[model samples]
Target chain A: MSAQIVAFGLLGGLVLYSAWRVATAPLITHAALFLALTLVGVAGFFFMLQAEFLAVVQILVYVGAVMTVIIFAIMLSTPALIRSGERPTLIQQILSPRYGAIPLLVGVAVTLLLLLAYGTVSWDQVPLTFHPSSQFPGGSTAQGTTGLIGEALLTRYIVPFEVVSLLLLAAMVGAIVLAVEGSRGKEDEARD
Target chain B: MTDVPVEAYLVVAVLLFGLGLFTALRRTNAIMILMGIELMLNAVNLNLVAFSRYLPAGLVDGQVFAVFVITLAAAEAAIGLGIVLMLARKRQSVDVSDFTELKG
Candidate 1:
């Protein structure tokens, strides 16, 4: 009935479509693209949840950085063009058989039951507190979430914030070790 | 839905987890399985972020944890892919089923 419902319905549909694509797309590259769309939808949901900063970070970090890395990895690994006439998987193959429709029907039924059960549950009683909205004083609305987040990171959450940088450093070291192992093996093979 | 319920996030997470699970099971490629592992890790990150948003108190901690998780995911991909590359160089295959030898 309300505009909010319409928006949610649309987002939900988009989420489902992208998720399905993420699962069913045969090519690894298309699956990654679908993952990017799903990430975008998730960022939109974060905005709706009033986490604008998180939404931006999701788009920046996941879409911009991580997905780029994944795409590069895929490109580095796979052949220039996928060989035609290659079979997808047994799951897809099963879809054409006589018993294929049974699993599909069961899945639909389970989804419907879960939806019905969820509708019967009461969720309004959960305790929730929102940060002082940006619309208020302190020029919060004008400056937006980044300033507040930065302030909090420095003042209130300084220790844990720095700890994350260290974690990333460790990850970088680990990645280097793993990547170099491959090169060492290549040199060995050259000798062989 | 008026207010997006916490259950909504959890349900989406469960679905994502399932996709990761299926991918891990069905994909014969070792690199693809690593990608599936990354998906599972992202699903867990989404769950953490969702709880942080809904609960209101554990904001920065959740964000910090998510950052760590993302870093770990990247490291995992690098290491896992490196191993695959080396395996392909040595064993000349990326199929998981081919990895039967215990040692050099």
Candidate 2:
């Protein structure tokens, strides 16, 4: 086995294990932390895929920003709810012979169906090497991906880029409004 | 140097998506469900990056699209967490099963 395959096996195992924990960990806080680990593993995959820019963004955005938001949400929640909400062990739930098995079954079914679909296509024609035309932006080097992506964002993808910025602005405003309203409601209840 | 096959990456992405689906369906906590959604998004991003690396003529489009997807995921997380916080405040619980006001 090549070192690349071994590395991939290790990273993939870490990702799958952490993802399973995120699904089954009894404590909400533990699950959130596990989710961060899963994201980090995915970032490792991005690095192995030669998308260095994306790897950095994955760590920065998902592991850093998104995980922080999730942890904060978990912290702000009622302690009683967080403590007592999800208490069943994964094995117990799977073996309970009730609706507990449904999620697992559904997940397995979806994965099998997707694999079946993937098998229908012949991917042998796809090249395993990363070779972009010399005319392509960034010239196909590992370091060029970031520059290429930046150029694309400004040139061919300008419209979508601008729209996403607008969407982010809207989402930010909406979140602040919702959060402020929630706290204001609490204050009103206090006054009453 | 032996390169990893794109199929290997696809398999990992598929497994990740399945696990995300399971988490979203199995968890009653709204934040956990959101986490599951994030996992699914990450899986999709993996697929995009893998294709970008191996596919001829793919150039940088896949990476650009992945960036957009990541941006969208961030926005979705912010909005989803905000809504969940509001629900928790009003209902005193984050359990999805408890919010049944619309069952009529």
Candidate 3:
């Protein structure tokens, strides 16, 4: 339990810090890297929560796929688009411009409200464990985390599964179309 | 595995969400705003998984929801990044503030 606590503290701190860096990093490339770190930290939390499938998926999708695309976008774009000509110092980046104060106030207010709600809830009084017999009909334990998730995905949630597949298909096609069109336009400009 | 309190997860979720909110609102880059949205979605997934584990039901509902969130986030990121690229190509920039020609 002590080890779990320590791991959680470390992972949680890393997540929070990197998330702040994702927001405040001056360069888009730096922000994307910090975003990847934040995703890895969240994957740690997923593992701590014993959701093995989620941890793997989080690492694969967020860290592998999504972060790669974001970094690619940062690279493909001109430096002027990725970062302002002025490379602000870290302190200046943290201070940001005057516009930052509004968002900061809003974010802090939302966080405090959530914390207040969390404090008022009596989560400790709630029973944490459920009978294994009630969950899995066979004599399997929670070690089969991935199996359980697969079963749930297919059996009870088939409709949403098909819908998500369709959504992914549409997104893939749309992305390709947009990318090709942009290149074509650039080619036309070059000809001009 | 129930040794950890649900509150701890909730606290982390709140912090992630807050950071995401700040990122989304403050950043002018469209891609950074998209990253912020991803952070917020991950926070929601954490909340769902924590409840799924701690609630007496112990069902995999939370994990299923989390999977969906991840899928949708991936889709959103692909489309959003494409849009950002096109915007950059069109205006020679990806800053959100510069794309406000539709402002009435």
Candidate number of the best lDDT: 2
lDDT of 1 by residue, B6-100 (tens): 68776776666656655565566676677667667766777776666654433444554565566567656656776666676667677788887
| Candidate 3 per-residue lDDT over residues A39-143, each given as its tens digit | 999999888777778999999999999999988887776566555666767566546564487788899999999999878878667666643333532225645
Name the best candidate (by DockQ): 2
DockQ, cand. 2: 0.71
Candidate 2 retains true contacts at a fraction of 0.82
Query: Which digits, one per residue and each the tens of the lDDT, describe model 2 over residues A46-116?
Result: 87777778999999999999999998888887576556664666678887653358889999999999999
The residue-by-residue lDDT of candidate 1 on A1-192, one tens digit each, is: 656556656766676577666655677777778878877877776666555676788788778877777776666665542343575475864474432344345445545665666678776765755443343222255554456567777888778768767776776787787678778877987999
What digit string (tens of lDDT, one per residue) describes model 2 on residues B85-104? 89888888888899898999
| Model 2 alpha-carbon drift over 4 Å, by segment | A81-86, A96-99, A126-143, B56-58
Best by TM-score: 2
Cα shift from native, residue A175, model 1 (Å)? 2.3
Model 1 chain B scores worst on lDDT over the 10 consecutive residues at B55-64
Judged by DockQ cut-offs, the docking class of candidate 1 is: acceptable
Off by over 4 Å in 1: A88-125, A130-140, A151-159, B55-61
